[model samples]
Target: MIKKNIYFVPLFLAIFSFVVIAVALQLDTSPEMIVGDSMQARSFPIFLMILNLILVAVLILQFYKNQPNPIPLEKFPTWGSMILFLVFYVLTVFTDMFIGIFVVMFLMCVLWGEKRIWVALLTASITPALIFMLFDLVLKIRFPRGILTNIYYG
Candidate 1:
């Protein structure tokens, strides 16, 4: 049945994600700070990995209970889109947050999205700006200052 295939994608993705996270959790990292704070850097990744594993199990159960032979192929976010999404995430590692967000937003708008031109531009501009303002202004958090940081906050 069509529904059977629909379940396959999430199931496969969940399994793959679980394996990747498990391996990452095993890899060792040196402590950046010895402050012994609750907000340690490695905490989020470990928490998310456990959460993802639980979600996958739940989805697998739902698939078996509802769809007899769930096939997950009718929908296509496509390999290229997935790769680009990953690239966007990876890009954040090498660059400042503002530049990284803007690059990813513009690419998503121009290459894959369906909004009107002005709308896409607005999204590319406004979303990152708001995020910066929220983190920088509201939360008073430190972020890597890209070119705009000089103009906006400097």
Candidate 2:
């Protein structure tokens, strides 16, 4: 029974990837160029979806070749990660993307059983700072206005 259920994961992923590819195909391909000879907006997403499908196929093949030991469902962090994602979304919508990133990183580190509080704090702080520097300073991209971003942009 467990062996049979394991295939569902890859099957669901494959279905989701195909659905995303279909939606990506429907995206408008206007001639707006962000850079010289840039591909359409949907190109990268479609490519990624195709790659996902390929990975799903590989996973299925691996499962067939080697019947792996089943891990307990309760041992998985799926629900916790999903909840964290929802919280991150809410934080990003209300507070700021930087705030969401920092909070989520810290929470995820703790959730995954990180023992050191200082390491979690560093991960939370440094990750957002690096992201801000890379996008705001290096790439010259402006983040949407929010609590922390407003201070930086102003």
What are the TM-scores, per candidate, against the unseen true structure? 0.46, 0.55
Task: Provide the lowest-lDDT 10-residue window in model 2.
Answer: 29-38
Error of 2 at 67 (Å): 12
Residue 13, candidate 2: Cα error in Å is 10
Q: Tens digits of per-residue lDDT for model 1 on 20-128? A: 7777667666565763555455556667867877887887787767776533453343655666677776666665567767766776676675558787778878998
lDDT of 2 at 45: 94
The Cα local distance difference test for each model comes to: 0.69, 0.89
| Number of the predicted model whose lDDT against the real structure is largest | 2
> Which residue pairs show collisions in model 2?
none
The TM-score measured for candidate 1 stands at 0.46
